[model samples]
Target: MWLKKIGGLVAILSLSFSGMAIAETTKDNFYLQVGSNRNGDPIVLDLASVKGTEYTLLEQHGNGIERRTLRAACIQGRLFSRRLAVYESNGHLTRVDKTEQEIFPKPRSADANSMEIVCRVAANRTK
Candidate 1:
């Protein structure tokens, strides 16, 4: 059942991105939309900043934005935020966190989608 749900979500994401061009939708060419979360907030991955198993993810949250450095454990199929920066709506940096919290993304959540995308890319990079 869990596999089925993840597959269904992947299908939905594929369809959603099929009609849109990444360059036209994102603010810049370096950021690609991974997918939106349950709340419909856009989640984007910074393509140029990806290094090995780490990726930079930018997410829209309410009236603010968050930039996170996520380390994808491709083998374990999980990821954790190594660093985070919260920004105001005007693009002002409000807070920066350098904590090494290892919170796994919940199933079927936006973070799950991000983990799935990042892990897939990271896995492919090794091959």
Candidate 2:
């Protein structure tokens, strides 16, 4: 009876550990995929590690920008800033933004914490 109990405990532990896995996002950087299927079914992939600023395209849709590097702390396809849409590796609009880039001359030197982007309003319509 004791032998049987020990075996059962081992089996239970093994099964529990099998499903115990850390999410793709780690202590540093990562990736994710959020979009729809061919039939317009929503899907998501919390990816593994992502190294640099340049994103890696994982999958592409027929219309929207290709999903790429996982934005840490993003939810429901939006970033922490709650940006309306995402973009492609090649820098295509995620939806339709009517924003413009700030055209300020670069300072003598750059600060690690300061970054800038040029935003443009979306022209395409998808509802």
Candidate 3:
């Protein structure tokens, strides 16, 4: 009797966990929308000055315009949004010298993230 009771409890716990996972997925979907402003407003990406090696992060968010600084690292980086592709530079794992045709028109084909990095292959060649 005890073994049966314990098995039933485990089954209930498993179901609860699965339900929670679905909820988490729904939360992430909000960010995929272009003008949705899932976090109540758009995020502002920026680079900090005075103390730095030049890495821009999503620093602020609000006031309608999501701002971002075009720093050196960003010059040949890879950024993606809704179907629009942005070619910019990030430090090591990036390659920003390849032309749009060579990158996007690759032979094998790839996801957005890979396509962007492939285009910027001058810096990050292999992996």
Candidate 4:
């Protein structure tokens, strides 16, 4: 009876530890699909390469027209845009506008407009 209890405890502990490992891996590697542009081209934002509190917003436009990067911050699972400076692929700041609205993730909804850009947490496929 004592041996059975010990085995059950071990199994429980192992499962908890595995869950923690999975959470840690996903905590910093979240991605957001930023939707498509006015031209019907898709855009994806990758936050998986974030380091510490700072993160690089990699904007990959579907067409070969525009590709930019913006410096941002992530706080408690909510990403905040810090500036309006859009940088080129070569690290050159091209446009700076203080009126640019900050971006954040929103819940996926069925009534979302097709032209409007909506962001949501990327689904984890490892499950």
Candidate 5:
């Protein structure tokens, strides 16, 4: 009977250690939907594809009809901004570039928009 109890305790310990390992390997994703732009077009941002210190930022508009992807690396780099700004023209994604600091001067505030939030979260995760 004591042998059975020992085996059970060993199993429980192994399971708990495995759970911690899984949690360490797992990556988190952040999703947010900001309000519409000047043309009343909705915008959405998803940061799900995280690998190490890098992640992919997926931006969608007009209910996913318009999509833009930005490969963001949160590691130490020369880039001033980690998040890429998606420029839309006439309800279409036209260009993507590193976001300007001036655009999100108060990024840490609770009222920050989706882009600022994603940028901050991604950078923090890298650290």
Candidate 6:
């Protein structure tokens, strides 16, 4: 009887650890698919992470993901973006970069689509 109880406890512990491992590999559901980029990869925006004029965008790369933090200039329709970090498909941080770039979206481009959605959301919040 005691041996059975010990086996049951060990089983429970293993299940709990497996759950934690799964959680680490999955992303939260708050990121919404805004549009697709030039390469047809899905571009997602973390609406819940928006702060003031800055928002987080996640782009699907080969087997990993690249996350960028961008500040919007709504009136001028521009985005100031910085490469924040990259994560593996298993949701592990690979590296972090702070290289900044200024974007002026050309007509009918992926960046233009993203800028429109982001600015609209930001504009609505101020009212």
For every model shown, the clashing-pair count is: 0, 9, 7, 0, 0, 0
| Model 1: number of backbone collisions | 0
Task: Point out the higher-scoring one by lDDT: 2 or 6.
Answer: 6
TM-score of 4: 0.32
Error (Å) of candidate 6 at residue 93 is: 1.8
lDDT agreement with native, every candidate: 0.64, 0.27, 0.23, 0.33, 0.35, 0.61
Error of 6 at 26 (Å): 9.3
Tens digit of lDDT per residue, candidate 5, span 21-55?
11111124333334334554434344354344333
Query: lDDT by residue for model 4 over 48-70, one digit each (tens)?
Result: 54333334333332312233333
Candidate 2 Cα errors over 4 Å, as ranges: 1-29, 32-36, 39-42, 45-59, 63-82, 86-89, 94-127
Candidate 3 per-residue C-alpha lDDT over 1-127 given as tens digits, one digit per residue, 9 for 90 to 100: 1112112322211112212211111211111111112454322211121012222222112321222222222244433222112222221222222232212222322223223222344245434
TM-score of 5: 0.32
Per-prediction TM-score to the true structure, in the order listed:
0.66, 0.21, 0.16, 0.32, 0.32, 0.65
The root-mean-square deviation over C-alpha atoms between each candidate and the true structure, in angstroms, is 9.3, 19.0, 19.9, 16.3, 15.7, 13.0
| Shift in Å, residue 50, candidate 4 | 1.0
In angstroms, give how far residue 36 of model 4 lies from its true place: 2.2
Ranking by TM-score: 1, 6, 5, 4, 2, 3
Which model, 3 or 6, shows the larger TM-score? 6
Clash pairs, candidate 6, are none
RMSD of 2: 19.0
Model 2: per-residue Cα lDDT at residue 21: 18
Candidate 3, overall lDDT? 0.23
Candidate 6 minimal-lDDT segment of 10 residues: 17-26
lDDT of 5 at 40: 47
Candidate numbers, best lDDT first, in rank order:
1, 6, 5, 4, 2, 3
